[model samples]
Target: MKQAIAQYNEAERLARQEKFREARPLLEAAAKSGYGRAWYALGNWSIHGIGCRKNYRQAFECLRKAVRYGAGREALFDLAICYETGKGTSKNVRQAARCYIESMQAGDPEAISEVARIHYWGIGVKPDHSKARRFYLRAARRGDLESAYLLAEMYLTGEGGTTNRRSAIDWLKRAVDSDDAKLAWDAKERLKQISAVTM
Candidate 1:
């Protein structure tokens, strides 16, 4: 285990230096030693064409092994995205939801919004606006500014419950500080529109 971890750490250093070709063999060696993180790195790198040709199929296989070996929350999140978008695997909302929820429980903050998105849009299941709203609110409360924006949209549209303009405004205000520039701009625009309506 220690040797595997050492190899993985060295591979990570090589990757940081853009020596992806050299890192590949080390990652493979670590993965062969049953290191989950090495499998995860290989899977992620494969998809991005870091050291080899971009191969979603290969990435998917590695991700599955990574999850099986408890690679960490990142593997679950990436697997969920693959399942949700049919990128490397068949589109399976149920599987995506399971992965998202598991990732969220494993401390992946972004997974919360993804779970809400599936419920909000009814990707592969029935839309549950109430559930979506609840999940969005949970994420927002956790300091996810993008989730605050989504929650505001739901409030304004009355998707889950009663339409509350004030609540919408409140949520939008929270979202205005988002690090996502586009979302921050949109939130400001929404606030302006709301203000214009009252004036």
Candidate 2:
């Protein structure tokens, strides 16, 4: 275990410095030696076309191995992304949603945002706008900027149920203040519309 941990740390150090060629072998070694994090990292490296040619098959295999070895939210989130995007397998929204839900249960903030997205968009299941609102609220309260923006949209459109102009503006303000530029821009647009309303 100690040796595996050392190799894993070394792999991380090498990868962080962008020494992809050297890091690959170290990560492989650590992953083969039963380091779950190494497997998960290696999976990401393969999936993102980083350091090596994009190989979804290899990424899926490595990520699955990671989950098998007790990888936490990171692995599940990546796996869900892959499923949703058809990276390794056929695009399977149901599978993606399941993985996102699992990751949320595991307390991954990104996963929470993703699950909220799935709910809001009705990606893999029947549209449940109320459920979407609940998820958005959860993520927004946790400071997920994307969710905050979604909450604003929902409020403007009355998507969850009743229209909430105040909540919409409040969430838009919060999203605009956050670091996510895409969501900030979206919030800005909504805020403009809301401000322009003659009441």
Highest lDDT model number: 1
In candidate 1, residue 68 scores what lDDT? 85
Instruction: Give candidate 2 regions above 4 Å deviation.
Output: 178-182
Q: List the residue pairs that clash in candidate 2.
A: none
Mark the regions of model 1 whose C-alpha exceeds 4 Å error after superposition. Answer: none
lDDT of 1 by residue, 35-56 (tens): 9999999999988999999988
Q: Pick the candidate with the highest TM-score.
A: 1
Query: Candidate 2: RMSD over Cα atoms?
Result: 1.8
lDDT of 2 by residue, 64-155 (tens): 89988788667999999888999887899999999999989988877877777888788887778888898889989998887888888888
Write down the lDDT of every candidate, Cα atoms only: 0.91, 0.85
Compute the lDDT of residue 109 as modeled in candidate 2: 79
TM-score (all chains, Cα) for each model: 0.92, 0.91
